[model samples]
Target: MKIKQGILFLITKSEVGGAQKYVREQIAICSKEFEVYLSTNEPGWLTEHVAGEIAGQLLDKRIESRTSIGYLTRLAKYIKEHGIGLVVTNSANAGMYGRIAAKMAGAASIYVSHGWSSVYNGGKLAFLLNRIERYLARLGDKVICVSAGDYEVARDKVGIAEDKLVLLKNCIFPVNATAAADRPAANGRLKLLSVARFAHPKRMDLLVAAMKGVTDAELYLVGGGKGEEEIRSYVHAQQLDNVHLLGEIKSFNGFGDYDAFVLISESEGLPMSGLEAMSAGMPLILSNVGGCKEIVVNESLLVNNTVEDIQRAIRALQHNYVQYKMPVKSFFDINFNLLVNQDKYLGLYRSLIK
Candidate 1:
């Protein structure tokens, strides 16, 4: 497929998360098929992790009235100057500026909502976010939701047209299958996995609280984030020796260093990590929310956000690990693998440029 115009990928931050993962994978795949340009707040951690080479620019701007407009003008100018034909924005913040700038520059724009901001925020904040998304929806030529639930919110709550909203579930390039030792732990301890940025929605505290009295259970918290201090402080305060703050270790494949995988996020757009863990053959104890719920076919693994429910779910997995492993792998191979879904994304880009 010969491509005429460069694809500009605009995102708010370079932080490590599901949205960042999507950006990395998208660029890795798209760069092979087209010219990929990235614009973000800083050359974040993802700068080092992508699969292929990309041209990136730093466009830092506060989410304010005057400052945002200045950034928008600069972005529009950049798009026109670079001859960028398709502008795709990730996350809500970038969606705001990128969509409007793409409109001003006469470039086709697609806003990829990792998840609705309104779904995660509360009270007055949620109300404001709903209005912001509704406004951004008009500026974007197409709105891509990373999950079906997110797609529903884009149509029902954000008021994006059903025709304009597209559900492009997150996918990752398949990894070589690693042979992990059977059973969670030989020392009689249950190794639990939690891979997420230690951020607000991650709810690491809830995970720790659930671990309070669970016997022979050790929780390994992975990834770094702004919420690191809060999570560390809580773990220290509780004197929870069973919980090990592994920081960000690249070594632990969800199955090898852990017995079971778990993520109790408040909201998500079909998290790629859960899929990654499943590909590694780890049993899951997921929150009954968003993509995780959809990944785990068995309702037995899904639990509410309460500590008791999490504890109950974890205990159930610990007792019946083998029963859940098959379904987890089945879900990942069938839904989240990029090999099967890459053409759909490529065709979307091709259609836009055509």
Candidate 2:
């Protein structure tokens, strides 16, 4: 069967995080089966990273980038020019604009809800964005949630219909699975790695405070964000010698060096870092939020987003470290592989068209 022609519009303000990476990978995979086109802003790290593949597929534009007016104009023009049958938007900014543009252009639209960007936790601006999202959900043909937890929030809290929502688990390539079997023994110092942008919701401060009770073990803070300076200041203020802030290491070439991986986020849909950590054969310690508990299973430790809870989990994991075997990579291969999940998306596309 001849594949459909579609436009994958990514309106991420920044490209240095998991959502951008997810969009990029999805585009790459979907391109194999569809005439996939990408739309994103210029001068973004994501744009720069995606430049090599942008030869014929990418559309570079400096639109309102976030608001509907600027994005709808650019998106409508592109859809008209390319005969795009479907529009898929990732992230909140793109979801808003893409849904509106698809509606205006009379095209089918799928909005992927990565997470609740502006929740009750954020301030006035966040509340406003939340309202915008609720409005956008009503306009979209379908809203894709990366986790069931997120889907529930959208349905119950945001007033999106259950039928309008689709559950699509985040996909990850488990490159580390093969190498994990040959991993070296844990050194005397238990190494805990957290790979996430230093943002407000990530709550790295809680992790740092949790480390106070964890003796001798080292904590590696990977990834950079707006919270870098503040997180650094707090680390300095606390004299956290055991915590090492290693700014965003994109490739996990040396990931095996760490004994285990941990994340202490206030919220998430499904963090790719935790998935990567699991694939790398490292036991996971995650905050009991979002879909993390779903991935971690009994083999991993779940803690509340508090210093004491985090510290207790860390210590408990360290004490029972030897007994914990990394969850088998087969779990990811069977459930979260790109090929497998892509088929689910392809099925959704077919259903929509029919």
Candidate 3:
């Protein structure tokens, strides 16, 4: 019998965001061919979902600072001791330390940039971050970019070599229990849903601001983060009765009730929530940033995430909703389906070993 090679996945934190979810999906998909292990800064949603299913370790380091010498040393020792053959790092901080540690431990490393936030951030901080990312790219064998937009930015803007970067768009398993709801009557109010961590690049405030002019619809925001208090205060001060903060929901049972799904983020990397909504055949309204355009039903549904554009897109979707909503499942099936692309990942990993 042949021994299965060991694969270790690492991420900066284990929060239930897009990057964390990506790592979780990789663990499930790759476990079929390899011995899967996971390392996160601390145990949270990712750990919770994968608990008892794999060998998980805690790094106990946040994404805040540069690499820690002690953390790197410990990680290298763990990789060497466990016979880990491949180290897959997700997010910026993990990519930095994990790639270096993988090299030190004699493991091939792959860095998955969930989104190149540094390139889009703008100003001196963005310049410094891009330089840092460019320098760090040398430590990894390959960098997986989740969207075409990010891929272009990595190659063109960040000046990473074309051969070293892989353009593998994000994928998700379809939602099974839910399907798109029938459009509400012309006289009824539109029900819109958005699932996002209320933080930077996710302009929930813009969505709420847009809701002020949208008396004909109710917007439900389903997430919690550092930005929650600020958003709550803004909503209360603005007295937007139509907007409701639904917090985090782990199930898709209630998704079928919404007329449409909206994500007016300032930046994104092919959001899992948007794909989940589309898997349920819900129409998705997204901002024109990152990989959002790659999944939208139509260009008309793309917004600048401004209050004006969001309000406009909502009204447009409400006016001709069925036309926009009908093809959601088809779009998701063709582009973002995980079942179809799982082999691509397997092939990539296999090739890396050879």
Candidate 2 local lDDT, 1-354, one digit each (tens) = 346556555565545677877777776666656666677766666666555553244345544344446556867777767767777888666777777777777778888877876663546686576677778878878988898888888877676788789999888766544433233244557888888888867988888887777767899888888888888888899888889999877654455677778888878888888777766677788888888777775634888888888887777776776555445455666767775667787778656542
Pairs in steric clash, model 1: none
C-alpha TM-score for every candidate: 0.91, 0.88, 0.94
* TM accuracy, model 2: 0.88
Candidate 3 contains a number of clashing pairs equal to: 0
Give candidate 1's TM-score. 0.91
Query: Distance (Å) between predicted and true CA of 46, model 2?
Result: 2.8
Name the top lDDT candidate: 3
Candidate 3: stretches off by over 4 Å: 1-3, 62-65, 185-187, 250-253
For candidate 2, the lDDT comes to: 0.73
- The digit string of per-residue lDDT tens for model 1 on 1-354 reads 637577888777776666777888888889887878888876556776652467555456452233476788788888888778899888767888888888888889998887776756655687777777777777678888888878877777767788788888887765555633366677878888888878867888788899997967999888888888888988899899998887875533545667777898887778777777877767778888876667776788888999999999888877876676656665777788887789989889878862
Top-scoring candidate (TM-score) = 3
lDDT of 3 by residue, 1-354 (tens): 222667889888887777777887888888767777888777688898877556556556544356578788878888888878888998777888888998898889899987787877656688788887887788778999989998999998888888889989999878774676678546678999999888887888888999999999998889888999898999899899999998877643467878898988777878888888888899889989988899997989998857998899999988898899888888888888998888888788877752
Whole-model lDDT per candidate: 0.77, 0.73, 0.83
Q: RMSD in Å for candidate 3, one decimal?
A: 1.9
